[model samples]
Target: MSANPSPGSPRVALVTGTSSGIGAAVVKTLCDLGHQVLAVDFNPAGETVAEASGAAFFQADLTDAEACRAAVGDAVKRFGHVDILVNNAGIQHVESIESFPEAKWRQIIDLMLTAPFLLTQAAWPYMREGQWGRIINIASVHAQVASPGKAAYISAKHGLIGLTKTAALEGGEHGITANALCPAYVRTPLVDNQIADQARMHGMGEQEVIEKVMLKNAAVKRLIDPSEVASLVAYLASDQAGAVTGSSWNIDLGWTAQ
Candidate 1:
């Protein structure tokens, strides 16, 4: 098991995509655990969410390499160092591979894959210096299995898992651990928008899309709550989970059982 931070010096965490959903829950969970947190997101609106959650907010477009580095710097500047890093900022583009816009593909890859790498590179030294760190990547069920009309998203998520393993391997000697979380559909704004898009694409009602498309693969047949994912994040971030590294934790409601 990992050792907890000394009293009066709470572990500092830097989490991205904090405007809503899993990111927001993560911020709250970390703060409640007595960790100092710096919430980073492209949306300025996240500042309010961060304030409410007792975390410092940094607004940056993580797709930009400089911005990614700046976010890590901002966290270190504010809290001395970052002990936990959550790369969760993501966007979805639902189109067939043939009709997928070149620009959209680039944007998705840049935001989801390249940005995480940039942020990890920037945070590595701090974690190495501190001799303890946790890197939790928010991947998707699509990372393990491909889906139609989501080439860019699936590709980025798959790449993220690879990055997690590499980080875990490199950071092992330095007391840092890295892992990925693969979740099925959650009740997030992003998923809500996806439901709409899928409905449009399939020419079905939104409820039908949710029942027939989103829940079709899951044995639970229900949308996952953001808090459920956050609870898993809490466990992975805990000192007790020190031995867990380079593993992908699935909160997918048995979707991948087949």
Candidate 2:
């Protein structure tokens, strides 16, 4: 072990959406790597996942601006300083732009786009002090390509990419690198619900929706695994990835290769 802490050393990581799916996998992966992880999610059920993964849980509605800052503060209090941040909490609503509810659109933007910005701003000072940090925003393939429905999710993710680039530029001198991960449909509760919603909206079976609608543009014929995405997150959070920032790394299984 080294006397001084560095990016390669275990660091404090604050991850959002720790209840299930990609967020849960990220918490587990980071904790297994010996990082002190503070798992934040709106669901109280996440406490169990955190305990099982050897992470501390912070329950908060990140759509609330104050809650975003509080999550960073909680991480600092628990682990002394935050060295990594994973903004992965989100939900999807499948509806045409004209038919989508106004309130729901605002809610999605608040949670997906605004919360990440607030959390990043809150964590900036600590990382600047340490001269090292990683901010990974869990964007989707929709960040690059759009679909018929899912106007709100697509919009938020697109905006998140812009945020990631701007943060990366601003944090360059301070050694705080920011990047976005764009993955295709991962096998998550959120994507499962999205499949169901898409089927209902398109008047098709769920399997048909998955095959024809979801994988229509892809060369690969399967949904991505949460662990696969988590593996990438591990690399981005490592000292080796210090030079990789301000870019959206795609994990889509040949979805956009065409």
Candidate 3:
């Protein structure tokens, strides 16, 4: 027997940032595995992707607290209950601290850090009422370490881990597990957008940036596929992983191994 809800009782999964990249892969993976996923993203394209994946779509600007709450409310309204909450929605703004915009800093923190906290707060009742839950934050390896020119992104990611720990501590006796996945340089649009910035900063070709800058510390020396991260999300969201909480699971090709 599977160590999860029975085949007929699929978990109602709510995934943010499902328009593309790891979030999209996660939505597709959960749906393909027979879970009912509610895909949430501000992007209209997310609705199309969610529809194509046979998951319900809820469009919302996650930076807004009302929108965050609505995302959870809509999931509960549609699926009757939310069993898995995946905080994968995020944006990247790369610039030196001296040049970073205040608005951008607040924007990234609101979306990446504050939004997850809000969503978790909104979904707490459902998870608590049912006495079963899984909360997965799609944090980056930046959560553990730092690099230059990403002040807001790095700070928010680091804050997210702390939020994850607190959520885990509170939910431990309530049958809820909260954990974060820290992945490095996945082949996503987010990373694709940063290549040029990294290249200019390092005075190298884009390919050189990837080879020397991005993959330099990683033992595997290759970008991770979104599906690889999705697989870990699947494991973390499973009943078998009941004991895995308040942990930062890294899929960074051994970047942090050193």
Candidate 4:
């Protein structure tokens, strides 16, 4: 458990992709726990998260380096300093190697991998100055295993694991920790989009896609809850998790167990 902040100390957290799903849940969880967060997304849903949680909201395309830096700067300007960063913004593309569009691959890699790198770089000075920070990258089970027609997503996630480890090693000296959460198929808007894409690609009904494409390899049948992932993110951001860096913690519902 994290130590409670002194009355009015209000820690500042920035959670990306707060428009919906896991990102929204994480913003709520952090707010309920007493952090003043900066919820960010390209979509307008971040404004809702901010309103409901009393967090500040920023609409920015994180794939743009300037936008990424400005978002982090905005949070620091408002909250005094940023204490935690959750890089949860991402998109998925489904295509075989032969058919995968070059542009799509670049877009996915830029959003999923490059954006985290830029955000983390921008947040580093603040964390180092405070000598405390938490950086949680939301990776996926694809970080560990291969899935057909998802080369770019898988590659970016896997690269994120590398970035997490390297950041952990470097940040530890400054009392900052970095880690990645690798969940399987969390019930989220992202997964919903993927289900539709997969169903069409495989010529199967959505139900068939869920059973075979999403859950077939998992030991547990049900999708993981967004709240569960949020709970883990909260723990990781806490003082109790200081020793838990350079790790890829899986919240997959037995997906990788097999």
Q: Which is the leading candidate under lDDT?
A: 2
Residues 113-179 of candidate 2 have per-residue lDDT tens digits of 9999999999998888888989999999999999988899999999999999999999999998999
- lDDT minimum window of 10 residues, candidate 4: 1-10
Candidate 4 local lDDT, residue 30:
93
TM-score of each: 0.96, 0.97, 0.96, 0.95
Q: What TM-score would candidate 4 get against the native?
A: 0.95
Which residue ranges in model 3 land beyond 4 Å of their true spot?
A: 1-8
Cα-based RMSD of the predictions, in order?
A: 2.5, 2.1, 2.9, 2.9
Worst lDDT 10-window in candidate 1: 1-10
The list of candidate 4 runs beyond 4 A from truth reads 1-9
Against the reference, the lDDT scores of all candidates come to: 0.91, 0.93, 0.92, 0.90
lDDT string for model 1 (1-258, tens) is 234365345688899999999999999998998889999999999999999989999999987999999999998887777788999999998988889999999999999999999999998888887788889999999989998899999999999999999999999999899999999999999999998899888899999999999999999999999888888888888778789999998889899998
* TM-score-better candidate, 1 vs 4: 1
Model 2's lDDT to the true fold? 0.93
Q: After superposition, how far is residue 240 of candidate 3 from its true place, in Å?
A: 0.5
Residue 82 displacement (Å), model 4: 1.0
